[model samples]
Target: MSASVERWLTLEGLSNVRDVGGLPLRGGGTTRGGVLLRSESLHFCTPGDVEHLVDVFGLKLVLDLRTRREIERDGPTAVARAGVETVALTFIPEDGRELPETDGVDPLVHIYLGYLRNRPDNVVAAVRRLAAVDAGPALVHCAAGKDRTGTLVALVLDAVGVERDAVVADYALSGEQIEAMFRRWTTASGEPMPADLTPHIPRAAAMAEVLATLDAEHGTDGAGGAAGWLLAHGLDEADLEHLRKRLTESS
Candidate 1:
């Protein structure tokens, strides 16, 4: 994996932040930075963090893949740099999307499991939006920035030729930031997780299992995983090639 350990060490109060620039891909090169940025939901981000993103990183767009209910519960995040935009790139567009329907579930793990079930289709949609927007320094996030965000990141990285292990490594990076907050959110009583919280270890494991299955079914080097997902969305081989050229490095 090509992640910069030092750069990945930034914080904005909201946990689960990352850069996709340095991962090892199939070829000698790495996925380029300044193209795609990933992170947890900015719902609780501090102004300083927003400044770092805007002034330091020059972030131009914020893609939110969160379900509608999550937005209502937490409300919009306040990143006070004025000019950065927030787009409702939610994966589930069902006029009404409800919380996992579980009263006392661990909010982090449960919501992702729910996302896996109810809005699996949202996965490709979110990726398409990210590509089509062409917004530089774009940041994509879901509440806790693990499941929805991680899935989307996986798609983008796979398209860019990043290896499965590297992709998984980039994803698990969130655990250090995510778990700390989850522990804080869960009281001594261990109230059922907030539903928006991410059970870093287990959730990442589950996502890895899904991707591994995809690899087993569709050869890792061929039209499976990201390529397969795109095709399953009805995209043809030619479309895939064009997308690769447009969004990734040339082979």
Candidate 2:
């Protein structure tokens, strides 16, 4: 749908980097390209990849959603070393708080809901920072660019009125690249991905459910929508407006 969108970026070292743009909105228009990108960790980006991000793509900000332990384990990202402003906002608690056990929900879905329930403040802060990026494009990334990155990107796209299916499709795109991602991760870390976590790959239905839950908890319109969800958490209206303007292209 909507020409399928330009979803992937082929950098030398990264396998999961993508431009979150060109998706059709509800009424009309498409998401503006180059404003928002989502990716896996940039810890292994090559020098050319760093230049491509900074000089060609104008990457001005990087929102790293990795935990302190993960960052320390992976080391610094090339984007940060290249002098881009990088912000670390942990989406999951590092304090050992466990997700509520829910019967019958997919484990991945449960963990996603846990992010919203457990760390609304951090989620809100991430959106506010993305909204404030006026100098150049902003890249948001987590370990695999699947869970934490997916949730935040979904919220941002939904807040800007991108169709639910489009957002879900974008989330599911990561599933297509999982093998390549695993290879990159293993090569970089010299450790195999845990066997127990292998089954929780990105699924379209999972994101669809996430949006449905958000709509149920927050009103579909008015102060109950995605923008309202952020507002209730702590983001100001100006930042919300800035986000909508920055991401959406007119019909």
Clashing pairs in 2: 219-224
Give the per-residue lDDT digits (tens) of candidate 1, residues 1-251. 43447537376475567777767777656666666678777865778887888888888878888767887787767752366777776765557757645576555445544554566556655555556535566788887676778777776677657877777777777676765667545653486666664335535565566566556655455634666755666555665554454455533
- TM-scores, all candidates, are 0.74, 0.92
Report each candidate's C-alpha RMSD, comma-separated, in the order given. Answer: 5.4, 2.3
Candidate 2: regions farther than 4 A off: 1-5, 133-135, 189-198, 222-224
| Model 1 residue 210 lDDT score | 58
* Per-model lDDT: 0.65, 0.85
User: Mind giving the per-residue lDDT tens digits that candidate 2 earns over 86-117?
Assistant: 99999889998777778999777788888888
Q: Indicate the worst ten consecutive residues by lDDT in candidate 2.
A: 219-228
Superposing every Cα of model 1 onto the true structure, what RMSD results? 5.4
In terms of lDDT, which candidate is strongest?
Answer: 2
